[model samples]
Target: MEQHYITVPISRDNPQDVFTVNTKYRVIRRVGSGAYGTVCSAFDQQHQRFCAIKKMHRVFEKELVTKRCIREMKLLQLFSNHPRIIQLFDMDIVYGLDEVYLIFGCMDASLHDVIHSQQPLDTVHAQWFIYQTLSGLKYIHSANVVHRDLKPANILVNKDCDIRICDFGMARAFSQTNSMPYLTEYVTTRWYRAPEIMINSHNYSKAIDIWSAGCVFGEILGRKVLFQGRDHVDQLYKILGVLGLPNDISFWDPSEAVSAHIKNLCTTDGLPPPTEPVDFNAFFPSATPEAIELLKRLLHLDPAKRITAEEALKHPFVQPFSDSVEESLVPPYVDPQQYYIFEDVHNNSALKSMAIQEIEFFKHRMSQQELSESLLTNNTDGTITTAKRSHTAAVATTMRHFDSSSSWQL
Candidate 1:
C-alpha cells in the first residue's frame, strides 16, 4: 500500500484521470450504511485484494457531512500504520459528482457481530481482546487523538481475533497545544457512552474512551451489554445505579450546569433512588480480581481520576499478555503543536480544498506504481504522473496480545 502524502492539488485534464474508481475496483457487494454514508466491499485489481470502500454520500452537500468525511480521511491517514487501527488504502473524490470514496483494509466482522451472536467468550478470550483494544487506544490517545465513539460495532475483528479500531469520522485531536473540542451533548451509542458525555459535561477528556472500554470489557465477560440504557437520561441513571454517584467531592464540577440538570431531571422523573452500590466483583463475578480492579479504575465517575490508556496497559490484568515490561508501557501523552480542527474542515474553503488536493496527490502517487500504471493509462487526457510512496513508522511492539483462542468463530 502506498504511504504518500500530497498537500497540493494536481492539474487534471479529463475527469477520467480521477474517475477511475469503477475501472480500478470491482464492486463485490454492498456491506452496510449508517447515518454517515454507504459502504461496500470491492476487489482491487491492482492490489489483488479485497478492500472495503466507504462511499460517503453527498460529501460536499452539507457543511456537517463535508467536515465529517474530511476529518475521517485525515485521521485515517495519520493513524494508517498502527496495527490495531484500521488501515486506509486509498481515497478518491469524484470532483464533478460530489462523491467521496474511502478505501480501507477489510476485516471479517465487528465485535458487535460476535457479541450479538450470543456466542460465549471465556476469560482468556475476553482478556486478550481487551488488551488489544487498549493497545490501539493507547497509541491513539498518546498521539492526542480521541475516538469519541468506541463501541463494539466500530471495533472490527477478523477470524483470528485481531481487532482494528475503525470509523474515525467522529474522532478529533486534543492535546496541550490543541484545545479539546467541545464535547457533544451525547456521543457514542447509549449503552457504551460515558456518563460525562451522557450528561453533557462541558469539559471531557480521554477518560471517555476508557469508560466505554470498561463497558465493553464487562459485555464480553457477561455476553450482554453492561449498561443497556434506552436513552441518554436512562444511560446516566444506569451508570449511577451500578457505580453509584462518586462519593468523592471532586467528581462533580460545580460550575458545569449539567450536574444540576441531571439532578433536576432525576427529581422530575420521580425515578427511585439508586440501591446499594454494586461492587465490581458482583458486577463481573466471572472476571478475576485484577480484571475487576482495572474495570473499577476505568469506570470511575470523574474523568480526571479515570485510568488512562497508558496506565491501563500496565495494569495487572493485562500483565499476563505483556510481551516486555518496557514495551507494554505506552508512552505518555504529548500535546502536538496543532490539531486538525473539524469545524475548519467545513467553514474554511482552504481546508475543504485539501480534500481534492489529497485526492489528486493520491492519484499522482498511484500513477507511479507498476500495478497502477494500466489503471491510469485509461486516462484520455494524455498526461502522466509519478511520486514515491511515503512510509510511516510502525507502532512500537508490545505483548503478543492474542492467541488461537483469540479468534471468534461465531
Candidate 2:
C-alpha cells in the first residue's frame, strides 16, 4: 500500500480523474452508508494502495457535508501519524461534491465478530485488546478529543494480535472544560452507554468514553455485551443494576463546573447509593483479576473519579505490552479497527472502489502461497492448517458450524 501524505482538492471541473479506472481504480462495489455520505473501498491504480473513499452525496446541504468533511479532516489531522487511530491522507472536492479518502492499515478480522461468533476468548487476549484500546483513548483524550461512539463494530484485529480503534465521525474535542451534547454526544451504541448519559445527566465528561471502553472490554471476555439494553433508560438500568445503583454523590453536583443539567434531570425522589465497590469477577467469573480491576476503574459512576486514559494505559494489563503493541503507535500503519466493518462496505461506494484492490491482493497472495477460499481439509498432523496456509492467524472462532473449538472462526 502507498504511504503518501497529501492535502489537495479536486475541482468541480476536473473531469473526475480518479473515479473513472477504466476510471482509474476499477470500481469494486459499495461498502456501507451513514447519514450523509457513502464509503467505497477503491484501488488507486496510480497510488497502488487500498483506499476507502468518502464521496459526499446531495442528501444533506453541500455546506453541511463540506463542514463535516472539514471536521473529519481536522480531527484526522489532530491525530496525524497516530498508528492506533485511523490515518487521514487526503480530503478533496470531487465532481462538484466534497470527497475525502482516509487511509487505514489492513486487518484479518475484528474483535467483535470473533466474540459475537460465540467463541470464548481468553482473558489474556481480552486484556491485551482492551489495553491497546485504552492506549489509543489515552492518546486521543490527551489531545482533548472524545470518541463519541465505542462499539464492537469499531474494533478490529490484525495478524499479530494487535488491536486498533477506529471511526471519528461522531468524535468531539474540547480545549477547555465544557458540558454535553458534546460536539458529538451520541457516544456509543445503546448497550455500551454510560450511566450519567443514560440518566440524562447533561453534564458529561471523558469518563463516559472510558465507560464505553470498559463495556467493549467486557464484550471481549464475556463473548457478548454485558449490558445489552434497548433504550437509554434500559441501558442505564442495566449498568446500574449490574454495577448497582448510585447515591446522590454519584450524580452531578451544582457546586462543580457543570450547568444546572443534573438538578434539572434528577427528580426529588432520591435513591440510595452504594458505597462498596461492585464485585465484577462474580459476574465475569472467567476474567482475570487484572481485567476486573481495570473494569472497575473504568465504570466508576462518578465522572471525576473514573480512570483517565493515560492512567489506564499505565495499568498492568496494558502496560506490559505498551512498548511493543502496534496499535499503541499511530500513523504510518493501518488501524485494524477501521477495516473491521465486516464487509459492510461503507455505503457501497467503498466496496465498489476496493474490488480491484481485493482482486489484486488476492492474486498476489495466490501467486505467493497458492491460497484458496477453501476451509480445512484432511491433514497429516490432524490440523489442516498445519499442512498448508500455516501462516493464517487463528482466533477463538465458532463461526463454522463444526469448529466449535476454534476461538477465532467467528
> Which model scores highest in TM-score?
1
lDDT of 1 by residue, 1-410 (tens): 54422221112453332222556677666567788776777788868999988877667777767767777877776676677789888888765667788999988778987776645566666766888899888878777778888999899987656789999877777755546754442467778888776554555778888988989888877778888877777777778778766433336556446555655445246874364568777767888888888888888888888998878888988766664321332245433323364454435465558667767776666557755656656446776755433222221233233333434432
Q: Could you tell me which 10 consecutive residues in candidate 1 have the lowest summed lDDT?
A: 390-399
| lDDT of each residue in 1-410, candidate 2, tens digit only | 33333323233465343332124443444454567555556566755766556555541244334334434544665564555666554443333332444444444446676777655456556756787788778777665567778777776665555566666766765544553233323456778777767554566767878988888888776777888877675555456556754436435554543323332332235543233545677778998788788888888877889998878877877655554333343343433234323223334344333432433443355445433435436577765553221111332341122233545532
Candidate number achieving the greatest lDDT relative to the actual structure: 1
Error of 2 at 306 (Å): 0.7
Find the 10 residues in a row with the least total lDDT in model 2.
387-396
- TM-score of model 1 vs. true structure: 0.78
Question: Model 2, residue 7: displacement in angstroms?
Answer: 23
